[model samples]
Target: MTQDPPRLSVTSQDVANHAGVSRSTVSSILNGKDARFPQETRDRVYAAATELGYRPSHAGRALAMGKSDIALLLMPNATFGPQLQEGIDSLAGVAATHGLTLMVRFADPDADETLRAILNLRPAVVVDLGVLDQAGRELVQAAGVRLVPQVINNESNEVDLLIGRMQVAEALSNGRRRLVYASLADWRLDPVGPIRLRGAEAEAASRGVDVTHIHVPLKAAGATEALAQVTAGSAERLAVCCYNDDVAIAILAAARQLRLAVPDEISVIGVDHTAIGQLVFPRLTSIAVDFAALMEALLRELDTNGYGPPARPDLRSSVRLVAGDTT
Candidate 1:
């Protein structure tokens, strides 16, 4: 090695030279503003940079720009947990590729407190996965900051209800009505439950079939009572569409208590398509929604500016008619 040509002091200028473009053009492309240039031209600059291993130090760029280049991710909970952690992981990967910092904040459900915490971060973009209520939306907007809401459940009117509603609709279509909806107390008013119920009602109305919809509070005693009604002899069919797999598993346990034969006498369905759904007896006929893809699209939307028209995802997951003994 002839000292590797003095290490070549690789810079944006070198990239411009290799790509036959101006230094300014290389700057724009490396700063994540390649939209200003044609795709071909952008590709050439990127390729030249890769060939040279030209890495622009993000910390140096932030210092020169008087900006932190950080992204703030906000969620509903008071702390980062598993679901929020997953979002952080995915978002962090995207941020690193773009040379940005990621800061996560959990909303305390108190508007003032949450708003203050978010504003302090001064993020280039804010992503909200936990904002659901009207007040929550208004609070974020009032912050005078760019915010992206990822309310998959009924937190906001914007996000899709693929998981909950689809599960309910599919369960009914499979002739598994006499449906019991079980939910933990916190999820009772969740938009998912009502939306799914609406879908079920619409389907039931169209078919002119009478289906019993029971709302059972999620608890051991309450599940016991609901199980009795579900397994009652008057009902020819029995199925439970739980708010989530946990509730469904609990109902399954309750069904066992009542000596009810699953799928033969009752079928159980659940939302979330969680691992518990698979581990349960007879497997479970569950609505499989792409939570990961949903999160990806959501972060992408948040990172971009000006609330461009919402784009629908090409990948759609349907609830599998998982033919377990329970239907």
Candidate 2:
């Protein structure tokens, strides 16, 4: 049997002909340079392009504009939790409004190879979640591609710090003075754990509460062992601020095994406010990061750096305490 012929992609010239305008006019209007044109002409060009299902070719645009309309978000090698997923979704939504394509890539340990591949795409800017190494930064700079959240900014660490502060504040408000920071045992899985720990430490210091640091693995046995260290020789109530909900849940399980009463013997607060945290017994209290607000701030930063459009004016605090039985 004979297969159907492949359909050809619609082009700007086709849109121009359909709209009874020149190809240059179609290009200008579609590329957001239509201020000199009348509203009626701009409307005609947009309507024709939409009707014809025309999409600008990234390759062609790159040749004309020196870079493609792509915003690449470089994520560190870690578990993609609910909060991270929500931030990606929010970024994609905002990018669509600015006529930019959003792309995600897991950063490889070999920064050279990963960055080389990224440069091939000719992205307008490279945005990272604060995991880019010095080598990666040098390579991106050498290639002339913009890297967002410069070293001085430390915005990613600031967010982690906010999560840390929020977790400790919740525990403090519940009248738990003795504070413990439960960090993930694996550093590769949590590059930002140190920043969060610092935030917890800073908050605790301001309140005159000392925070002990402990590593808790995801497994039940490891978590139980860590909790034992916190409770040894001390009958005072403890508050544990976890790196994330998974870590918090693990501590909860350990507490159950040890027959410790939650929020009385020990209080737990987590970050991300994951769904599983709520499903467990004595539902977990967590710190919820408003990913939408974070995304808007990121977009605004990009716009200020001359890489994207202006972000919406509405912005609010990105972190809040979520009350639960655990805290």
Best by lDDT: 2
Candidate 2: C-alpha RMSD to true structure equals 6.1
Q: Residue by residue across 1-327, what tens digits does model 2's lDDT show?
A: 975452346777799899998876776677665777899999999999877878778777666767787778888887545877777777765554455667888877786767776778887777777657787787776776777655434544677877788888889896756899998887474667888999999999989889999999999999999999989888989899998899999999999988889988899998888899989989999888777667757766665655454444332367778899987
lDDT tens readout by residue for model 1, 1-327: 432332336766788899999876776578664665898998999899888888765455445544345667766552111343455566665654444556666666466776666555545567766543566566655655556643343334222344444545655666645655554545312534555555555555665644466655557677778678656666576766666666677777787888777876777777555666787787876655545555566656554455564555443442233444456
Write down the lDDT that model 2 would get: 0.79
- Report lDDT (CA) for all predictions: 0.60, 0.79
Runs in model 1 deviating more than 4 A are 1-68, 78-88, 130-144, 149-160, 173-176, 187-191, 209-219, 229-233, 302-304, 315-323
What's the distance in Å from true for residue 306, model 1?
Answer: 3.1
Clashes of each: 1, 0
User: Which portions of model 2 show Cα errors greater than 4 Å?
Assistant: 1-66, 154-156, 187-189, 305-316
How much is the lDDT of residue 261 in candidate 1? 79
